[model samples]
Target: MAERSIIIIGAGMAGLSAGCYARMNGYKTRIFELHNLPGGLCTSWKRKGYTIDGCIHWLTGSSWGTLYRVYEELGAVQGRQMVDHEVFVRVESDGKTFIVYNDIDRLEQHMKELAPGDAGVIGEFCNALRVLAGREMPSDKPIELMGLVDKLRATKALSVLKAMHKYGRVSIQQFAARFTDPFMREVFPEAMANMPDLSISGLMMALAYGHGRNAGYPVGGSLEFSKAIERRYLGLGGEIRYKARVERVLVENNSAVGVRLADGTEHRADVVVSAADGRTTIFDMLGGRYVDDSIRRYYDKWPVYEGFLQVSLGVAHDFSAEPQSLAFRLDDPVQVGDQSRHWMQMRHFCYDPTMAPEGKSVVIATYAFTNPEYWNKLYADQEKYRAEKQALADAVIDRLDKRFPGFREKVEVVDVATPVTFERYTGNWKGSYMGWMATPATEGTWMKRTLPGLANFYMAGQWVFMGGGVPGAILSGRHAMQVICKKDGKKFRTSTP
Candidate 1:
């Protein structure tokens, strides 16, 4: 039999993983990327010797878990050093401070000390973490592929199942309102990195992983991390083409056959897998021919993670002793385009020495905003866009100077990245870094990887899975490969190098 060849679109986390696994399963594969480099949103850039990271605050499964095997198979976790932080985040408002500790016991004590009135709810929260932290990670394989034994393993953890049932539907914002103390009420909503709409169940799982030292930051940044996986794919005899923008999925007889590039070049393959932007793949590339109502509802009604304004600074000052992340409310909100901001979170990459010079560190401030049209319009006017970027950076710098005192003088470089930058570079719709928002209703929801009427085609990445980011991206890729192997009457195979 001639080797079945597969063509993949978008060289992001999901695309790279699919290529690697396809090769492992004895299939020839090639990946086409829109950008000149890999990683897509999972990347970083250098400015004046400082590396400004755009992704990867912490990668879950860096140490060991069910998902760790997936990372190992994709060449993401091996030979990578993981740094576990003691504190998750330091949130401050009006001189009052709240720290979320990785250690659940210590966090419980601190929460009680800070807000004795809310101790009942505090115990409820801490106990959930304690229970989940002691539990083992679930299987990484797709649920449909699991055997009876695997299904039993998944359901045997009654405590974890009960915990999920108890708190699965509660949003962080809703839970924060249940606090009796005024301070707790005000700060709890923003505790999970200012993602108020995120399900509390999501936070519990992450904190649980962190408590076991299973989740941590890589010593290098996001780009280097993505490069590791790329190297793995190349080593597996997979081919990748940079600057190859896939414009359309060539379909014949209602089946995906190959792809046509922007420059009018066509490539034929036996199978096609897209890890590209969800909106473009369904509505544009496929010409809206293979979608049903479910697909339409997802695109129309689902809430995506809004695009944010990022201010990057390389400072001459050392911040080795400072917290990795700090979220504080400002008395006076700084104007950044059409949005007004009250809270700002500054993240300093002091733990990873590769980010900055010997005596300096890289600092990033992100302001979340929802008005995508405002940025889309501003970007059209080059002068207005440039001026807005500078203004946002200046306002962030000024605020930092007040908080840190003498901080402005230590700055050596200033850079800004907007929604326009992301949309232009990665082609993500609305500049959403993560494809979908991790909300109460969306948690654990799985969209069909194969569109209703499409054959020989599969979609992977954050779009297919409700929970976005690295975990969803890699899993979706693996699942696609598994489905393809099953269809070809071959067993799915994976090997760790």
Candidate 2:
């Protein structure tokens, strides 16, 4: 039988993962990417001899388990050094610091010492983390492929499910409100201010994963990790066309047949897989004719993760003794968009030597949940956009100088990427790096890959998967391939590097 042909949109983690699996299953595949380079949102760029990493603070499956196996197969983790941090985050308020240690016992003791009045809630929180530490993510196989025995084995996740049930409905804000200590209340919410409505279950699971060493930072950062997957796909005889932006998915009698490029070029394929932005794929590329009411409701009502403005500085000062991640309350509020931000979070790359010069470090401060519309409108006026970026960078530096004393003098390079920058580069909706915001209402929602009344076409990436991240995006691609293989009456197969 002749091999089927597939065209995958966006050469990010999902697209690359789909290509790898397609090739392994005897399918001829080609990927189309808008950017000249791969990795979409999972990317980095060099500025003044310093590499500013834009993504991947801690990969959930960096070390072990089924997700790790997937990474190993995709060559994302082959021979890569993974760094596990002892302190996940440091929260500071009024000159008092509270550390979130990777060790559950240590974290419990620290929290007790900081807020002895709220020791009960702290103990409960730490106990939940302990329970999740022993659990592992299930295999990557789709639900249709799971047998009776596999279904029975899934019972092992009962403890995790119970834990999630108890805390999944409570938001981080609500969790913080339970604390009696003034400092604890301020620190708890600030620690997770970026994800204010994020469920406590999500919080515990992240801490648990970090404590268990499953979540670790891959050395060399996002671009290198993506390059590994790109190499794997290329090695499997898959073809990729860079700077090829798809304008539309050609449909015949409600079945997808191919795609038309932006420059009036056309290519036909037996299958079309889109790992691009969800809104673009449905409303723009497919013309929004194939979606049902549920899909419409999701697109209309579901909250997308807010975009962020990242200010990266190449500092000559060494921050080897500082925590990798730190969040603190600002004495004076800084103007960001229309709001005044009283808290600031900065991530130090001192642990990774490859990011900076021998004695220097790359320090990044991200202002999350910034309104994309504000940046989008500001970008229309080129001079104003550039001016605002510079002003914001200056304000951030001035504030940092107060905290670090002489930080302004040590800064050799400053790079600022706004929400508009992400939209221009990766084509993400509203410049949202992560797709849907994982709130109490949308925590475990599983979006269907195949749209209603649409055939020979599928969707993958962060958009389809709630709580979008590297692991979920990669797994969504694998699942898309599995669904395609089932439709084609072929067994899905994967190969390791």
Candidate 3:
């Protein structure tokens, strides 16, 4: 039998993973990326001798587990150092501060000390974290391929399921309302303000993962981790074409047969896989002919995660002693686009030496939920757009100076990336970092990789997975290959670096 040929769109983690697995299964594959690099949203850029990392806060399954195995197979974890954070987050409200420590016991005690009146709820929360920490979820196969034994093995997660059932219904906002203490109420909401509607179960899982030291930041950050997988795919004889923007998925007789590039060049293949933006792939590339009611509902009504306006600085002073992430209420609100932000979260990359010089650090502040259309329209006047970015940076720096007395004077470089910047670099719809917002309404909702009435095509990316992240995106690619392998009557295989 002739080897099936596959043309994959996008060189992001999902596309690269699909290529690697395809090569391992004796399939011919080629990947086309819009940018001149891999890693799509998982990317970084250089500024005045400093590397500004744009993605990867904390990677789940940084240590040994099913996810770790996938990382190892894709070469994402090979020869890479993982930095385990001692404190997950530091939140300040009014004049008081609280730290969420990696140690559950320590975190519980700290919360009790901070808000002794809310000790009961704090204990309940910590106990839930402990229960979740002891449980593990299987990731070896897609749901369609899970055998009876696999189903049986999942029974081990009953305790986790119970905990989730109890807490998953409550939003972080509602969960905060359970706290009687004023400080506890403010702390819970502020700590997870970026995902305000996240379930208490989701928060518990994150804390559990952190407590186990399973969630760690890669030493070199997002770009290096992506490049590692890129190298692995190339080593397995997979081909990649960078700066190759795909204009359309060439469909003949209602089947995906190939792809047409922006340059009017066409490449035919037996199968076409899109790891690109979901909206573009469905509406623009395929002409919206294959969508069903479910698809329409997803596109029309689903809550999408919002993009951010990021202000990054290369500071000459070391921040190694500071918490990795700090969220504080601002005395003076900063104007960002059409909205005014009264609070901000700052991420310090002092632990990653690769991001800056020995004595310096890379500090980033993310102003969440910035409107992409606002930036998109403003960018028509290039000078005005640039000025707005600079003004936001200046305001953030002034605010930082108040917190860290010498922050303003010690800054050597500044780089700002807005929602429009994300849209230009990555074709993500509305420049969302993640596709769907992971709230109670959308969590655990599985999107079918194969669209209704579409054939010989599949999608592998965050767009197809609810509450998408590095693990889910990479695994989604593997699941696509699994479906293909089953269809071809061949077992899916994986290769290690």
Candidate 4:
């Protein structure tokens, strides 16, 4: 057989991973990215002397297990140091402070102390965490390509299954509602850190991973981590075209054969894979002709993750003693755009030395927008957009000053990225931080990589999967590669850095 060629769209984790795997399996591959750089949404930008990480709080599989294997294969974890924080987050309200200790025992103790009357609920939740400790997320195969053996291997772990079944559809908000204590009811839902709709089981699994020290922060932040995979892909002889925006998937005879660049250049390939934004790929690039009722329902009704704005501050002072993440109620509601923020969450880069200059620190303050469309529209008017950005920064800086007195004057660089920033830069639909929202109905749900009537084409990215992250992106690409190799009757292969 002749050598097969693959055209992958987007130089994000998924696209890069697919290229790497394609090269490992003896297929020719090239990746096209819209940005001059790689990483897509998994990126970081330099401001002044600090690097602001736009994605990844803590990678789910920095230490070991199935995800670790994927990270290893993609060269994301090769010689990479991970920082495991003792405290996941420290949240405060009024006079009360709640710390989410990565150590489960400490968490239980802290919870029990705060809400002794809700000890039963706390114990139950913590016990569930124990059940999920070291539990591996299913990555052996995508459901579309899984056989009897693969299915069996996936479900053989009865403990994980039982835990998942009991709490898989239950939201963290629902679990928090079970607590009798007022404080527990208020803060328990926040343990997952703004993702209240995430399954309780999913939250448990994260705490487990954090407690087990398996998932930790990659020292180099998001972009460098992505560049690691890009390097691996290139090392494997895969090609990448930066600033090469894909205009459309070239379909002939109901099969993807190649792609046309935004520059009007056509490139032929034996198979075409999209790791770009989901809506853009299905509707815009493909002309919305291949979608079925199911696909339409997904794009129409299924909620995409929304409402994100990040404010990064480069402080001349060190906050190494402060928890990696801090969430607290504001004395005054800071109004920015259409949303008023009474609460604040700040993530410090004290753990990662690469993020800041020596003796300085990078602090990121996150605020939720009621509507991403507000930012999208606001971008059209540059004056309003710049003012809103400054307003948000000013408000956050004021709050930061309140939290740590005398620290405001030490601030050097202040950068604000709104939802429009994500959409404009990564071309992600609606500036969604994660592709699809992780709701009770969405979690553990599988979306088909291939659309009906579209052959020789597959999708790999956060958009294809609901539980969006670097790991999911990597696995989605691997799944695409596996499906392609299987179709060609060739054994799928993976090589480590």
Candidate 5:
């Protein structure tokens, strides 16, 4: 093939990573983003002096683990200060509180204390953790003969392969089921319910081992992360075009030729990679000409996860009653059966004082999992949506009042983001925060890839390689680029500056 240019759609984490990888590998790369900025749902927003992080909770490791090595190579961690979370997270239920620590032994002890007579279950769980302790994850490098060989020779590769051989095909539920304690079963379901069965708790267990080594937060927030990746990409001679909405990936016979933007501007390239929505890329943009039955079924059948409602609050004073800090699950479990009221979580933030004015606190109140039908019916009524959002914010404040007692009075600023907000800003279908859920049925499947049958087209981000967090997207971007590099007979590289 002749010297080729690659065009990437969507400037989310995955797209940015793909761009970087492609540039590193000596391919001319350009990215088109519908939004002006990057980072998708993981990006931060500012409203009246409050900086709210929409989705970042706690990343697995800072710069100590295998994955952190990738970040270090991407130039995302050099000179970046991270604040390790002192307390992992707390779960409050039925008027009882369970504090989860970074130490595996301490976590096991807490579990045992919470549910007496469950020592056997705890030990078994620990054994399972040990089994997964040194496991490896599938690399972002393309999955081919050469890639496999390189991976085999890479550091920690044998341990990863061993773990994969041992536990890759099983579901998380199945792994949890190995222990027969009610508490164990309940805990696994609660923790892993949102996670796909195939997420490799073995990989997560290794992360757990590494988390205590160093679990730090970025001082600036997610935007800083996005900017760092973008900076590196630009430094490598890659181009990122904002407000560029790709309408279709132009194809000649069976190979991806180029892409046509929404404004009817066509740019020619040898290969086109879509880090955008699969449905948007294949069916809507490509006019459904290339889709096979398998791809059709994926878009038409698989359920997309629901969106979130986020309320960012800037308070007048610090709510530092709890020294260690923070809870994951809310005090009350969301009432799935009830539709009249919504479930919300209030996160206490004193992590970065810069997030708010001096002596003030920033609290993020978020609640998700609403019915699509209810939201769709109100599209024509803007005032109604605004009212509902206000009401939702009020409910969150009420919940915070229960938890923090005097939280309602100190509210300096309150800004709400709805599903509509996400759809409008990020162009994700149905405002889904994560793409397709990586359940047992769809784990490690192609739903993680770009919409199938679209020529020279691939996708990255939460949509690919089983949706999880920022790390999954970053890794997937590298994978997509690696796959493209293989097609073009190139080598993978990363920019350090």
Candidate 6:
């Protein structure tokens, strides 16, 4: 019999993972990517001898013996060096900073020292995470939406419901309200104030803090991480084609048979997995034929997470006094018009100086929540848009100048990337960096991988799954591959050979 063919759309982390897994499991696989390189938004760009990572803050499961082990089992970054951040992270605001320590005890102590009466709240948070650490999650495998209830029942029974009750029902905003300390409130406001409506469950919150136990970064940045996985995929005889935009998942008689590329290239496949932008995959490329009215409406109404305008700077001096990455905020608490005023996020390459030339450092200032219309108008008036971008970069530099006195003098190169740039690169609608927000209505109370009435078609990455960060995308890819592997009656190998 001929070998089963699997065609994966997009070469993002999710697509790469799905392709890697399918190839390892005896399925012939090919990946199509619009961009010349993979990794999508998790990619990095080089500007004037500085490497600027796009969306890397802190990745969970970088430490061994954590839920992230799934990545290692698949040989995602087996030999690569992972940097475990000693201090989890810190938010510097209004001359008062809150440090989240790697050690829970030390973090609790810091919280108590900062706010004495709020010890109970901090203690409860720790206890909740402790309980979650003990609970065993169901297999990472993806299955039919109809089979979720049965699978959960068989795996954890009432425990799953109990877990949801404890961590899934409440939003981060509701939980942050429990604190009486103003500084603690400002320090850890749960959801970013701008994202108040974004659905963040209690379990996810715990996992966020739980990451402090093992905060980390990949040595060569996000792109290197993607390259490592791609290397593994190709090592297993998997094929990847760049500039191949998939037009449709070829379906015959309610089963996916193959795909047709934009260049009129046709490739047959037994299964098709899409790791591209959810909106594009669901509505545009597939023509929304697989999704139901309810699902389609959810997509139309779902607000995508805010986009960003970033300034990648190569500084002549070092800003490595601090151990971990820092979040620098504005003096005035209220929101301001300039994207920089909304959130002045500064992440430096002090930990890894190799990102820049010797004696210099790479600093990225991201101003998130910018309107997409601003970029659209830029194309009409190039000079005016260029001036605006320079002004925004200057303002961010001014803000950093206050934080790091005379910081502007060292700036050798400043490259600005707006939402339009992200849209052009990743094909995300409105240049949304986080895909669609994983709200209750959109992601569903129970996460569903495959859309209704879709034969041999599946959705992965931030759109359909739990909408987690890097780990979520990788898991989504693996799960989509699992669906194919099971249908083929092959033994599902969890680890790479």
- Number of clashes recorded per candidate: 0, 0, 0, 0, 5, 0
TM-score list, all predictions: 0.98, 0.98, 0.98, 0.97, 0.86, 0.88
> Which lDDT tens digits does candidate 4 get at residues 1-497?
77899999999889998889999999999899999988988899999889999998889988988889888888888888998888888888888999999899999999999999988989998898888887775775877777888777877666887887788889888998898888778877666666677778767877889999987999899999999999899899889999899999999999999999999999999999999999999999999989999888888877777767888999999888887888888889888678776778888988888889889999998865347888888889999899989988888898889889977799999998888888888888878877886667765666889989999999999988876788889888999999999999999988787
lDDT tens per residue, model 2, 189-264: 6655457788888778788989989899989989999999999999999999999999999999989999999999
Error in Å for residue 434 of model 3: 1.0
211 Cα displacement, candidate 5 (Å): 3.6
- What are the per-residue Cα lDDT tens digits for candidate 3 across 284-348? 99999999999999899887876667899999999998888999989998999888988889989
Lowest summed lDDT across 10 adjacent residues in model 6 is found at 333-342
Instruction: List where candidate 1 sits over 4 angstroms from the true fold.
Output: none
**What TM-score does candidate 1 get on C-alpha atoms?**
0.98
Question: For candidate 5, lDDT tens digit of each residue in 214-326?
Answer: 54667778787778888888888899899989887888887788888889999988778788866677677788887678777767876566666667888887766653333
Model 3: runs farther than 4 Å from truth?
A: none
In angstroms, how far off is 178's CA in candidate 5? 9.0
Kindly report which residue pairs in candidate 1 clash with one another: none
Cα shift from native, residue 402, model 6 (Å): 1.5
- Which of the two, 2 or 5, has more lDDT? 2
RMSD of each: 1.3, 1.1, 1.2, 1.3, 3.7, 3.3
Q: List the residue pairs that clash in candidate 6.
A: none
lDDT of each: 0.87, 0.88, 0.89, 0.87, 0.68, 0.70
Better of 2 and 6 by lDDT: 2
**In candidate 1, how many clashes are counted?**
0
